[model samples]
Structures are given as C-alpha cells and as structure tokens.
Target chain A: MNEVKKLPLQEAANCLTPALRLAVDRLPEQTARAAEELRLRVGQPPALSYGGQETALQTAAVTAADLREIVARAARDSVHSYADSLRQGFLTLSGGHRIGICGTAKVENGNFEGVRQFGALNIRIAKPVFGCARGVYEQCCRGEPSSLVVLSPPGRGKTTLLRDLIRCAAASGARVGVADERGELAALRDGAPQFDLGGPADVLELCGKQDAVMHLIKTMSPRIVALDEITSAKDAAAVGYAANCGVEIFATAHALGLEDFRRRTVYRPLLSIFQYAVEIALEEGERICRVHPLKEGAPC
Target chain B: MLKLLGAILIIGASGALGLSARQGLRMRIAAIDSFLKALSRIESEITYRLTPCDELIALLAGENDPYAAPVFQDMAERLTHNDGLSLSYKWSRALREAGPACGLREEELGILCDAGSFLGRYDSEQQRHSLRLTAARLSAVRDEAAEDLKTKGGLYRACGLTLGILAVIVLL
Candidate 1:
C-alpha cells in the first residue's frame, strides 16, 4: 500500500504495450505486488504469473503483429543491434527486466543464427529485494573470502539475494566485479546502474558469462566476482578459473538443495569450486533459505 | 499616372508569386537531396554498425541539417513519446507533418512512408537493401524536381510578367 509496492508495477506498466497495459492496470494490488512475469503467446490471451501461481487475464488474444510491435518497442526500434540477445532468446530492457523470447530459431550450416518472428514473450520483472542479504553475509562470507554459490529453483529470489550480497561486499570496501550477462544484476542504463547496490561495482553488460568473468578478473581488479544462472560448461570452467586465481566467486544456480545441486553433470566443476552454498526456497510466503559450509572432499 | 501605377503593382505581385513558385520547387529538390543523404547514412549504419532505427533517427536529428533534421527529429520523438502508435504509423505521421514545411508533396511524402515501412521490420541485410532502394527512389524524385525547376523557372517569371500586363490592360 506504500511507495515500495507500487514501484515495480509502475515500471513494468511503462514498458507494456497499450493493450497489455489495459489488462495489467486492472490487476489487484496484491497480485500486482507479487507479479513476477507477464506471458504473451500468439493467438492466446495474456497471462500473469506471480506469488507462485499463474492467472489468465481477461484481455484480447495477442496476434503476430502485436508481438512484432512489442518486440520493436522493446528493442527501441533497433532489432539489428540486439542480434546477440535475440539469438539467445531473451533481451533485457532498460530497467533490467528480461523479455524471454520464444520463436523459430534461424539456423545456418548446422549452427543457430537468431530468433525469427517471436511468437511468445515472457516478461520477467526484476525485483531487487533491498536488505535481503542482511543476515547471510555473516554466515557465508568467512576467512580468505571463500567462494559461495547460491542455489534455488526459478523465481526464488536468487538474483535479488546475490545483488544485495554484492552490494554488501562492496560496501565493506571489497572491490566487486559483476558479469551482468543480461544486465539484470546492475540494471545499467547509459553506463549507470538503476538499482542502488550500496556501493559502486564494476559490471560488464551484454557480454557472455565465461568471457566476461575472465575479462573482469583481468581488467577490473576485484576481490570478488558475481554472475547469475551458471548453466553452461564454459561458465563452470570460467568460475573454476576465477576460483583457481584466488578471486572469490559468488554465483547462482537452479537447485532445490545440496543433493540436487551435485546431480547436474555440467555443474560438477563449479560445485567443487564453491566452499559455501546458500539454498533458497519459497515457503508460506516467506523465503526459507540457508548457508551451508561444504566439506573439502565432497563427492561430485 | 494612375494607370501606370496600377500596372506596376499588378506586375510586381504576379512576379512575386512566380518567384515564390520557383523557390518552392528549389526547396523541394533541396529537401529530397537532404533526405537521400540521410538515408545513405542510415544504410551505412545498418550495414556496418548495425544501428537500430531509433538510434539512427536520433543521430539524424542531431545532424542539424535544416531540411532533413526536423523530419528525423519528429520520427525519433514520435517513436519514443507516442507509446501506442506502431513504428510505421509514427513514421508516416512525421513525414506528413513535416511534408508541407519542406515543400514536399503528398506523393513525395508517400515515397518516404514506403521506405519507413521497412525501417525496423527486417534484419540488417534486408533493411540495408530496403534503404538503398528508398534512396534510389528519392534520388529519382529529386531529379524530377530538378527538371521541373529547370524547365519552369524562366517560364514562370515570363508568365507572371505577361499575365500582370494583360490584367492591367484589361482593367484600363
């Protein structure tokens, strides 16, 4: 009912098209507060997912032309320069909200080119939970700046927690470098961050995870580095490489618990590199999560 | 003396109208040339730098060319400020709004609208080709306008003087 609850909805609505805006503007205040994503699929009515539940909107069905118009507006009328993001099936808007694209992939000679004629869009609203990292820094951040990995299922506030942690680390005078592959962590616009991350942290926007991690380590001297959604082998290797260089790495992944975290084959190298793991879960409308110290000889 | 003064006034007014007509043609040709030059820059930006249409429009607006800048500025403004309108709609609107001031005819503005339809609708290669085609068409329009200016320039002046003298004689 206060200013904080209205901020995200206001920003999200500003980016919504006119038709979508009509539907979004009618959402209940509580639903709007928890609204995490707005999904628009071609030929189907728009839907909203928030508070761990999906609800269909009483709005007109989206069309191909409407989707194209949304894409054009999101790209700010520049689809060509956003080729890489379009190829990756998502593009981050100015406010750090990522629009996950779904469409046909353009392939050439056994390699993927980019998305063609996107039919579905998942607009993920970035909710930076201020002070979310209050009690966790004391538990995980220990001697020698031990590497930490935050784990949770999707939409469990992993990025939000990570941003606060990065801010806390930087506030304590530890130089932090964030590899913002999707610009979500920093939400940079015109080379400046939209979120108040407690202190100034060096960020690399629109760069691939592996390359950005290595590049940040070399160029920006930092005691710690942060990235989101470590999903690839190259990303694991990059985290491994950073850990090997004795630069503390703080990152996130999608997993329920430590057992679930160790089950992924690609995450094996990354798992070994982290001495501390914080597992987050959404329970009873509250964040139930923890920081656990990993043994030295834990099996992959 | 009264008849002579009346004749002089009539001739002067007609002569001014003819000069104005010729000047309108000159301005139209100048606008077309400036638009072509701006389109060339947009083509390069798309082909090489992969600039988006909005950024290209912003760049064009900043170029400060008297003929092309206002039109580009209008486009950039409309795209950014007008939330509900589609890109093509805004583009056509801006061309229509800026058309009369720059001595652009409805057909000339329609030529721009045709080009603007392809602005943000394709990949870089496709967009670059569209821009080239648009520039060619605008160049041809400019050539036509130049031809009109050359042929009608003296004729307008002569007709203005002859028509004014005839009007005075009839009145007398």
Candidate 2:
C-alpha cells in the first residue's frame, strides 16, 4: 500500500528566488506541508494558499526580477527549453508541482509567441495523498474494471483521488495506461516514473490527451486508460471510443457536483460512457468523496 | 674569440624574444578562432536542440582547446557546484578569473563577458540572435589580430636581428 508522504512544500520553495525561498522556509512545518499553493506578485508580499484561503507571509514585497529568476531557475536557466509550457502559461516542475504564469503575452500574427515580463506566479504544490481512493476502489473497482469519471470543482483533490484510484486498479492485476499530458500524474524522469504508479502501469508523458488515449488503446491495449482534465470534445470522443472498445476509462473533470457535471453539455457524452462519477469535496476541513452511479436511472 | 661568442649569444637571445612576441600574437588569433567555432556550435544547439546553458558549457569544456577550454571548464565546475547564483553571474566571473590567461586582448575579454548576459535568458530566436551578434563582433577582432600577425610578425624578427648587430658593432 502506498502511504501518504508529507507534501513537498519546502521543495517547492526551493524553486523560488533566494529571498522568497528563505521567507517560505521560515514557515511552520505544519503550515508548509498543508499549503496548497505559493502565490507571488510584483509589489505584494508573498502568500500561501490553504484550501482556497490565502495567508500573506511577513516577507518583503516581490519584484519583477524575483519573478524572472524563479522562471529561469525552474527552466534550469534555459527558458527556451520550456517554450511550449511557457506559452501555455504553466510549467510542471520535476516533482509534479505546477507554476502558473501571469505575464504579458508576446503574440505574433495572433498566435501566442510566449510570455514576457511576468507579473505574477501561482506555484501549485502537488500533494499525492495515497490511499485516499480506497473507498472508491472498494465500491466501484473491486471486481470487474469499470469506466469512471472523477469530478470536482478546481482544487478539490480530484486529480489526487484519480491518481490513487489508478494505482489501486493497476495493483489489482490490470494493465493501466496513463496519458500524462501535463506530467502532473506520473512525473516521469529519465524514462522512469517518479511516482510509484504500480507494477502494471505505463505512462505516455507530455502527449495530448486525445492522441494519447487512441495511441494507448491501439498500441498498449490497456485494460484501463487514465487521463487528467477532460476539457474538450476531442477528449470526450476519445473516452467514448475507448469505452466502446471495452477498455475501462479513468478520467477527471471540473464541476461542482453530479448535477453541475450533467448540466455541462461538453460532459454529457462522457456521462453515458462512465458508470460512476466520484465527487471529491471539502467537508468540515476534511476531504469527502461520494461515488454516484450514472446508469441512466441510477439514484442521486 | 670571446667577442665573437658574446655577439652570437646576444643575437640568439634577441631572436628568441622576437619569436616569443610573435607566438603571443598567434596564440591570440587561435583563441579567438576557437571561441568563434564554439559560439557557432552554441547557436545551433540553442536553435535546434534547445540545450541548457549548463550542458552547453560542459560540452565546450570537453572540446580540449587550450585557450577556450579552461574558461568553459571553470564555468562547468561553478555550475556543477551552483550556489543559487544566476548563470550570467557565474559565466562572467569565470571569464574574469580564467579569461586573461587564454591570451585574449582586454577588449576581446570584454566582448566575451558581455555575451554571458543574454545567454539562456530568452526564447530560442532571441538567443540565436544574441549569439550571432556576439560571434560577428568576435570575428571582427579575430580578423584584426590575423592582420597584425601577417604584417608585423616579420617586422619583429628583422628588428631583433638588426638591433643585435648594431649593439655588436658599437661594442667592438
């Protein structure tokens, strides 16, 4: 069983500028481990976000140079090497932490060239909570493989639950293929997964979700395919196609609850394909996941 | 017999001095040429491979050029034991500490040091443009050094021998 490790908040702080890093390091260990994101903006004191609440640190205000240095360090002093991610306004660090960028876009011919003059950054720390999905696994994935959708509003541990669920399914002697588009799930380094996915898991890193799904189905012939952030029509279509082919699908999406998920037209096609929708939410300062069955006439 | 031996000794010492001066010029030219080649390779690496600055510096260090290699080697070492400093700072410091011994002129050292400021700080196109500009400047300096070697190289040797003969005649 994969045990939950302390969140790598100090590791994330090391990616910041030296002064800012010092300030963050001074935070209490409990606070550091509980932090969800590190927020930095020009002319504002650095802040840490905990479960959607932002707490300002007692450090000096951030500067433009500080922001530039953070980006440079994250890219290993080679900004051009991360041009694609910079254009997409986020950089996934080696430890699966994501640094979201807010900057002036240097667009050419209406195409986004890249970001320049960074104004702010949101460093979302990746906290992999192991065994968080045991309840869902026992309820939905005990016997036969099932297609399921993990749903929640943004920042509600949807991805975390989905990751643990993938590990559980893979441990049950099923071949699991992960389309890690943003590298947040597997965080493969030097062709080896940084996260302990499972013995039977194979990850295609940094590939588009739709293409990765089809490729995984055709080549790997996975019994279950897992992907993060199903946002587009293409992703839904790929999931539907994989379902039709009898390959179990595991995916996550952004919605408040099942009702909100069903109302979104982009997710309607996915509803029929997924037999269960795992809703992850925060209740009384603790995470609560409720699994809802969506077999046409299933109860709310 | 003693007078003749003294003249011979004088001429030999002066000739060696002239040759040493000429060798210095040649060394400078060779250093600049080596740097130019390294810059060209850096441009291609940045444009095509998107190689990081540290890896590129390490690659240059492995080239084994006596003049340019030590500077890159020093940089690679500094990057390996990085102390949270920027690449530009480490690069400029490496050149200041290791550049003069590479037989480059003060102006050439300044040009090379300036090139560090823009490296790994921008997109590929911008980086390529900066590297190309630095290369062109270094190439111009190399051409001037080559011209000096072609025109003044022989002059130093001839002057050394003539001065030796003049000193011999005056002493006799």
Candidate 3:
C-alpha cells in the first residue's frame, strides 16, 4: 500500500532503481522477510533499468488512457469526455512513474487525429529536477511588476525553470496564478500536486493559458499570471492583455536567438510586454550563459 | 544416462532463454522511447516553424504579396516516408485541428488525408518489411528463452518422476 496520506512525487521518483529487483526492494511488501521476497520474486525485474534494455519497458508505459488523464486535467476548465478526446499513449509521472493509455483522438467531424490507436502506456518518472532556475530568479522579478520570458531549444529545461519559479514565487508571497495547459507544471494526481509547486495562490492546471489569464485577471486577481509555452497569436495577445491588466507574465518558449524571436509575426506583439529573456542553449558547456534584454537587441 | 544428459541440457537452455527474453523486451522498449523523443522534437519544431510557413502561405495566397510563396509550396511539396513519423501530412492533419494555437485547419485536413494515403502506403510497406526482419530475430531469441524456462521446471518434475521409478524397480 502507498502512503495515501502524502503523495510525495519526489520520494516516489527517488525509489525508481536501475532495474526490477531494486524497485521491488524499495516497495513495502507484506512479506515475512524482505530479502526472501527478492529470490522468490518470479516475474519481477532484477533492477530499475534506465538505459538500453529498460528503454523498451519505458516506452510500453505511454498508453492513450494515461494521455487522457494528463490532457483532461490540463483542460480542467471544462468537463472532458473520454468519448471524444484522443488520449494519446502515456504520460510520465513525477519521479519517473509512467502512465499508459489508449483512445481515438477527438478531432473535427471529418478530420482525423494524427494520434490514433494510442493503445500503449509508459509513464516515465518525472523527478522534480532542481537547480535549474538559479541564475534567473533575481533578474526576472525587478522591483516593479516585471515580465520575463524563457527561451529554450526544446528538451533543455524550460519547464524545469518554470516549476522552480512557481516554488520561488510562492515562497516570496507573489500571489502567482499558473495556467498549466499540459499538466506538466503542477503534476497533481489523486487530488493533490505530486510535484512541489509551492502553495498555489491559485492554479488552473489544465486551462488554456489565454483563457485562464483572462479569467484569473477578472476573478483570481493574481499579481503574476504564468504559463508554459506561448504557441500562437492568440496566446501572445493574451500576454499583452495580462500586461495591460497590470499583471506580470512569466512563461517559456523555444527559439534560436533574438532574431528568431522578432521574426515570429504572430508572437511579435508579445515582445513589447516581455522586458527580459533568458535563453537556455542545450550544450554541455555554456548551457545557460547570456541574458538578453528585449529593450536592447542582439549584441547584448 | 540419457535422463541425466537431458537434465544438464535443460538447465543450460533455461538460463540462456531467461537472458534473451529480458533483452528482447528491452530492445522494443528502447525503440518506443526513441520514437517518442523524435516525435516531441518534431512537435516543438512544427509549432515554431508554422509561423513562418503561415506568413509565406498568406503572402503566396495573396496576389499582391512579396518574399515568394515558394515557402508555402515547399511545405506541400516535400516528399516524406519514415516508419515512425516521416509523413508531414500526419503532422499537418493534427495541426489543422489543434485550435489556432497549433495552426491546424479542419477544412484543409483532406489535403493531408490524401497525402497520407499516398505516403502511408509506402511507409507501411517498408515497416512491414522491417518488422518481418526484426520478428525473425526475435522469434529465435524467444525460442531459446522458452527452452530455458521449460528446463528449470522440467528438471524438478523429472527429478520426482525418476525417483518414483527407481523405488518401484527396487520394490519389484
């Protein structure tokens, strides 16, 4: 039985050993002797394997039902029916626990979803990755209501930074409202956030960022309205609305450099509101070096 | 003498079979993980890449536009065929319905659908060939693993049966 009392996402992720045998040892089994459980264990794996052989098992975890749960929760602003939603394959849980799923993708009546069948599951454990936002905290929150945007090359740690910011902001009493559209920010399962997202002044887990920003501005009255990735013109416009409403906005995106940021016509309007930006370049050395100020272009 | 030789062979085969099953499961899982990672990279790229594509498309569609609509044409013209995700049409179809944020159009999905039909035939054919090759390798490995498992269990049962026969022989 799990510790139903406190759903510790970090702790659960920590227990994921290198292979099957190690994982079972971590489990609290009702056996007379714990070591005896290992030898007698017939079908279980030897260790929690991460690389090579274990990769196949990892992929097996991403089922469509798991996708439905993650996606449904992210769209929490409404009542999602599994009937129409395309629950991809799997969603990685906090600390590397994988959830699998299956379902037909709900698309327009005539249109087909690229994501079909969705009948496998692998909830890769997503550990609460720390030490990511060390440099950006002070620069992001200038004395006045400030807006800072983080740019990454993808797979670099944009969400990791956002998660840390949530923790940092909540600790600082900023009344932050996070609009996690992808259920990645505050991974809450079984009615509680598994990741340490601080105490939420307010959190709209699965709500669209643009819609949530408007709703939070009108109702929640948060000091800062945060979001994950700004993908479209509507989303960029919403950031402007948040700024106009005097609510600071914090978010992440993928881009090469300042030129790439400006070239984006749909997201261009957002540059005016975004005063500061930190670029996350995914290299071994100089991974995160320079901070770019939109007020001052490239040469900085 | 024959029974003893069979028992030795059984134990040896059992260990090898167990190892092989573990390896096969691992290989398939790795492929899936890599496939997903590839998909994510593509998604992130497509989202950002669409802005420029949309601009180029808009300009081309507009008679009084500059910078050439070749960019838009390029998107539709590109030839693709990958076992996991080579079809641009599959991606295009999803984007059309993914709301304004994802840049998918429900009306234009048919264009992608047609492209998918053509592209998918080749893709499926290639995948079938690849799977056949992989399946052959996997089958051999599976056989070895099964043989090993059978031996372990068989040894225990055979041990009991042989002992019972020996007792009967002595009693007679």
Q: Which candidate should be chosen as best, given lDDT against the real structure?
A: 2
Looking at model 3, give its docking quality level. Answer: incorrect
Return model 2's CA RMSD, one decimal. 3.2
Report the error of model 2 at residue B38, Å.
0.3
Query: Which is better, 1 or 3, measured by DockQ?
Result: 1
TM-score of chain B of each: 0.92, 0.93, 0.29
Q: Which DockQ values do the candidates obtain, in the order shown?
A: 0.61, 0.73, 0.01
TM-score on alpha carbons, each prediction: 0.86, 0.91, 0.46
- lDDT per residue as tens, model 1, A1-300: 565544576576665678788788888878887788888899999888876677899999988877777777777667777777676677667667778888887888978877777789888887777778867776676433557889998878898989998987887778888998877788775577877666758999778888898899899977899988888888888888788878988899888878899989988877667888889977778897687777574322
Worst 10 residues of 3 chain B by lDDT: B116-125
lDDT of 3 by residue, A1-300 (tens): 785542332233322222322334344433212111111111222223232123112212333333323332322211111212223233434433434343454355766532444333233445455656745765656444367788877656677788887677777778888776666677555346666777755776656677888888888899888888888877787788889999888888777766787787876888888877878775654467356777664223
Ranking by lDDT: 2, 1, 3
lDDT per residue as tens, model 2, A2-68: 9766358877776788888889888998899889999999999999999679999998999988888
lDDT of 1 by residue, B54-139 (tens): 78888999997999899888888887775567678888999899867977887678889998676876678778888888888888
- Candidate 1 docking quality: incorrect, acceptable, medium or high: medium
Sort order, TM-score high to low: 2, 1, 3
Error of 3 at A255 (Å): 1.2
